[model samples]
Target chain A: MITYDDEVVCAPRAGTLYDVLELILDRGMVIDVFVRVSLVGIEILKVDARIVVASVDTYLRFAEACNRLDLEHDVRSKTVPEMFGSPVAKTVGRAGARRTARSLTDKVRDVLAPEHEEAAEAEARTRERAERPRSRPAARPRGEDDRPRSRPRRRTETEDE
Target chain B: MTAPTTTAPESAPESAPESAAAPKALYVYGIAPAGIRTPRSRGVDGAPVRLLTEAGLCAAVSAAPPRLRPRRRDLLAHQAVLDELAEQGPVLPMRFAVLSPRTDTLLTQLRSDAAHLTQQLDGVRGCVELNVKGTVVPGHFADLVRRDDRLRTLALQTRRRPDYEANVRLGEAIALGVRREARRAAREVVDRLAPLAVRTVQGATDDEQVLSASFLLRSADEARFREAVAERARACGDRLALSVTGPLPCYSFVDPRPASPAGR
Candidate 1:
């Protein structure tokens, strides 16, 4: 069973920037005369968001979660809530983090969070100063429960695979 | 996993030439029917946005920021301008980062393609785009194991031997079964929700995200659509987690065909 907060996911909210990122970048009318800016970071962002590599780590995590399940008892009799202290959900949740795949989701959460742009902008500035390989956002360790429940919404079917 | 190297630093040099140009470039937000109020929202680069009118249509534009980057502030600003325009009537939101080299070029395109653009705008006039996405919920692993003989046998076998390789196989099978169930739930979601919208457009999907769809919904039907989505969320909460974001400018429904063949 999904958490009550997860159930609240159905409520419609105004589209955040990440929610409509694909629409803003990919869709919409473009007159031939207009210059579509060749955005540099955006290509990497799109590529990062889509590549869900089925790595050994993900398989191992899944196996660990499955090992905890009570296969002997019929699952139909007892719902998901009774299963191994939410291990499967936690595994599935962390599955998004496979091989830096979490960056997009982290970015999405960062964007969707109600906190203002100054924090994100400042973080971006610091990252620029560091000139480090794209590091994870500083915003990650905050209580995950505090994240405004927004679904991961991609707006195109095109694949790089 | 490399950090975004080209963040704010690269933007400064790029905008230098744009600022030096004779006729300043205009960053376009969107095109709407003539005479909506100039959007009060701060535009890209914090420039004030104004509408450029021609051919009975007005385009919301701002002096292109000398150094344009897809910064969070600017992207939100672009959407804000279009959202304001969309509130009043139909608007063809421009793709982000579309810059008119000069005001005249934009005016010329608007004049030449006004008829086709207007027709396209009319198609989405009373409608709004609501995007619904559903991700796989491995919360149902127990249920999946119960239902699938292969998964159940593997789970039992792995529990008995409990070795590294055996555990991996059992886990991979469960993951596969979870995705299969989620995909089926995702399909059921679209089937139930599609009938309520004027048009449905499917988006990308992978193992984790089973469904991403945009429904072109009439403004009035927005509530009903949400209701249907809520019901689906409850029914499939075990397998899929669904969320809706919109009443947005109809981005998907527009640009289905070239606005003007000659312009292409």
Candidate 2:
């Protein structure tokens, strides 16, 4: 079994607009007479948000983490505590295992922040969170300190398709 | 942002290119019983919102913004209006970007659909929607590697071969295994929580988001529901990460023409 901070992992976040975007956009009522205007970049927003993990990129990353593991050890004798203490744990932890484990809200934040600099900054922040021994998802709901103060423009508005 | 023209304008001329921005058009936010205090929340494009009451039902509306885009602020405003209305009484939230061509047209629809809309509103009275989303957590790699013989064998082979193809194969297997575990945990979560809700609606799920479901819960039961979610989050924190988002307006439960029951 894997061990981590329950406070960080188990606490339910208050919902932000991003958390309920699907509900706002897709689930509400529509009168046949009233027009539902077609949005310019919303298709891309919706599509990018629902990305699946079954890809060569994900597979390669997983294989890379597995290669760094200590598979030569006797599985029967090895225990959870020893596994956690081993260099194997550090290898897997550092090798994008946490990256694969990111929550959907984090991906939505990345997709919404389209500026290259902002995206890179967001990436660095995500890495920082991943490297922490126990940390919450990178994007907190609306009023958190996770977003950089410098991000003024709504970059997601400019995305095409 | 380029303005997207309305798909089919009921009364606008074919020659008119910008009918959507016409001053006569009203952006409809939601419907509720008449006489609830007007929502103080701003509408899309920062327009002030008001109610157009007809046939005992009223819609929260505003002069349609000249240009409509799904900007973050506008979306929040739309939700805020419905949320405020929901606090007062049952509300039927319109999907974002719904625009009525004219006040008369909106009033006609309100009159025609009052019985159905009121019934729909009653279904969700005193209840709130709570959405639960669960994602895969690959934190159990050590445990998985130990328990699965095939995965262990692949890990061993990849270490020896150390080739690109071999790594991809090993990694693909691991990803699949991790997703499968998370999916199982997601099912267990829904099964555990569904009983606490009056009704449940399952949303689309992909490999990464193993589960996304909304529960229409009574206001009094919201605490019990949240406690149940917290317990499940603790139970499966290793394999799946769960987050709850709501007490929101009942967006998923407001369909007048309800979809066939799919949630189990």
Candidate 3:
């Protein structure tokens, strides 16, 4: 049984860049004569944007938050107030949810940007070394490395065309 | 985020030579009826926006930018120009980064496609696009975990063992529960709000954001529609957080390519 709250009703607000991004990028008219520039990094940006959701990291974060709950307390009585009563749960509430949700595009933008790629690569290397050897090593890093490398290759291909 | 630096070097080089030769390609923002006021807002790269009219239709355009990336400023500039046009009357917004190689070609296109373009403008007339995005709230997630015997059992098991693998499994189960509730709320929201809209276009939804939908509604109905959204938001507030952005130019409602006269 979900409860309703006044705070959850966000006013109709002006759209942010992420809010209107797909509309601007994918929707609207594109005439045949018009040249729609093969925007470099857009694919990478989009892929990275969607990747943040449903990832193992996000699952882990969710589990960690839930683990802090005092399960001995009557679950039926527990609601938003009780969740917010705990300092840990308060951090995982509204503000945190909005931040996590909206951060996808920003994260994508940061991850796809060339400067951030180097930093991300360094971080990934360190993370890989620190974590237990995983089965899907080839799959994860390949996607990241491919974007930066393929960008240059795409430019050359377009030039030749 | 870093200040809007110019796009990377590799992209700059290719576009540079082409820009040097010509006056500049026209970066089209949108199509409108001829005689609308020139947009005061800056175009992409802060270019001065002007209009090109032909066959009773006008395309709000600026000098073609040297390089076009989906930079934050440029994307906002594109929306701003269309928004300015949309205030005056109907506009058929061009997708971001659309450029005409030459002004002559653009004029020719406007002339040839006038009927189709005008029809598209009419389709969106008196309507605004309200995009509603709903994200998982996780407020009632504890209730879910408690209600489901499997989840409760898993929680107890994980608490007892407290190993990394157990924690991951427990976390994954909680994540699924959170998303399932949010997604359920998302469906109910869309169902409730769909009636108020003339048309509804669903956008991509991921695990965190269970709903991303654009609703096209008459300007007159906008208030009622918003009230309904607020109601739904309150009803599902604990499981999903809803945000509405609107009175926007009808970007999602617009056709990507207007049917050519021959096809029509």
Candidate 4:
């Protein structure tokens, strides 16, 4: 029932380095002989990628976002991370990051209640194809007009990649 | 950006070296076993990756001349080539932007390190790599809050006395609660899938997505494993967005060196 596009947005992920850093770096063959190429940016890359999830700021932000929801609706307000376009979850400014998350939480409701999203997606996809040809999973894959660029969204390399 | 690391899609005819006699550098991707299909495309660098097949081994190599530095295209080129090769068989993927002094050095690597390479290939022979990604599912937070009386009490109490700081605190608590739920689901996914794997490799993690481990499974177990993934997907639909990648050649599973006597 899931098309590549649906799967693109929802499928269980497959094997990629991003998915197996432990197996490759920690578990796989580490021959002491062959010079393990001292990659320049690898350590930093790994460090940045695995930023700890627990932060007071995060808690405050979560609290902030939760405040906007219906307490009795039983609809758990989705965290912004759910709105991520790519695997990378880089929240640069704390305040903006929290607001952006509303979209993702909002999406959960839309996904579960599909009729509207189907129409929205059809329209979104057409508009998407017209503008940005490379709209990746990157967030904010739009143009200068702030009109929501298409495919190739910007995945982070800053606090995230 | 194209999810598959595809930057440029070129018809990789000869792979870099054959185009040579010139000094243009070729970007290197990962290495796959010999006889597996060459990727349907080229390295993100736009160079063709020629296979220098040796005794049961093939290096998915491209030419890299001097003055070559890592560019986004080149890194993506490297990823794309390996992605292509991985579709067929096990690949010993090089890190992004690895350049040899010349094709001669790479060949020398293949020639001298032939035994090591073969052993590396054999290590991943009957295995496939599967990547699992877990992202936080926001909807789960409400479920958690409702289920946990303690959290519900806190939510009600916070609602009654709502203030800027209080709301932030409540939201933060809820966020923490949601993340905990997500992390738990992530663990469950790993534990359940681990049984089907020969070995597992974990990648670094970040906040939004848990780009965790790859399970190297027995080729036969792939189906069962996929079935399990579907089950997991359905079961944990709202807690975590679980996406599975590949029956790929053991790119992450293969060793870079020849096995030592002890390792053997």
True lDDT of residue B205, candidate 4: 52
Q: Measured by C-alpha RMSD in angstroms, how accurate is candidate 3?
A: 13.6
**Candidate 1, residues A69-153: lDDT per residue as tens digits?**
5566542232332232222233233222111245335433432242354464445445543643221221122234323234334
**Residue B57 of candidate 2: its Cα lDDT?**
91
Identify the superior model by TM-score, candidate 3 or candidate 4: 3
- Name the lDDT of candidate 2: 0.67
lDDT of candidates 1 onward, in order: 0.67, 0.67, 0.67, 0.52
In lDDT terms, how accurate is model 1? Answer: 0.67
CAPRI quality band, candidate 4: incorrect
- DockQ of all candidates, in order? 0.22, 0.26, 0.22, 0.14
Candidates in order: C-alpha RMSD to true structure: 12.9, 9.7, 13.6, 12.0
Worst 10 residues of 1 chain B by lDDT: B2-11
Q: Model 4, range B1-264, lDDT digits (tens) per residue?
A: 222222222222244564433323334555556788767566543656677676667767664422334343454455566667766766676655454434444555666677776767677766777766666655445456667787777778877898767766676677677777778877888888888888876665555565356788877787677677656654554556666666544656665444443221
Ranking by TM-score: 1, 3, 2, 4
Top DockQ model: 2
For model 3, how does the per-residue alpha-carbon lDDT over B1-264 read when each residue is reduced to its tens digit?
A: 222323222222233254323434778899998999999999888878888889999999887666778776788889888888988988888999988776666887888888888888889988888888887766676677777889888998888888788878887888788789889999999999999999999998887678989999998888788778767765665677677765688889887876563221
Which ten contiguous residues of candidate 3 chain B have the minimum total lDDT?
Answer: B3-12
Q: Model 2: per-residue lDDT, tens digit, B19-128?
A: 43443678889999999999987787777888989899999998777778888788888988988998898899889998887766777788877778888889998998
Give the alpha carbon lDDT tens digit for every residue of A1-161 in model 4. Answer: 23232222322333233433443334333333222334566565455335454556556545544444345754323233232221222221110111122233433333334444445544544554565333112232212322222432332322222
Writing each residue's lDDT as its tens digit, candidate 1 over B1-264 gives 222212232222233243423355778889999988889888887878889999999999887765778776777888888889899999888888888877666787888888988898899989999888777665566667767888888878888898888877876787788788889999999999999999999987887677889999998888788778767766666677676777788878888335453352
TM-score of 3: 0.74
Off by over 4 Å in 4: A1-161, B1-27, B32-40, B65-72, B256-264
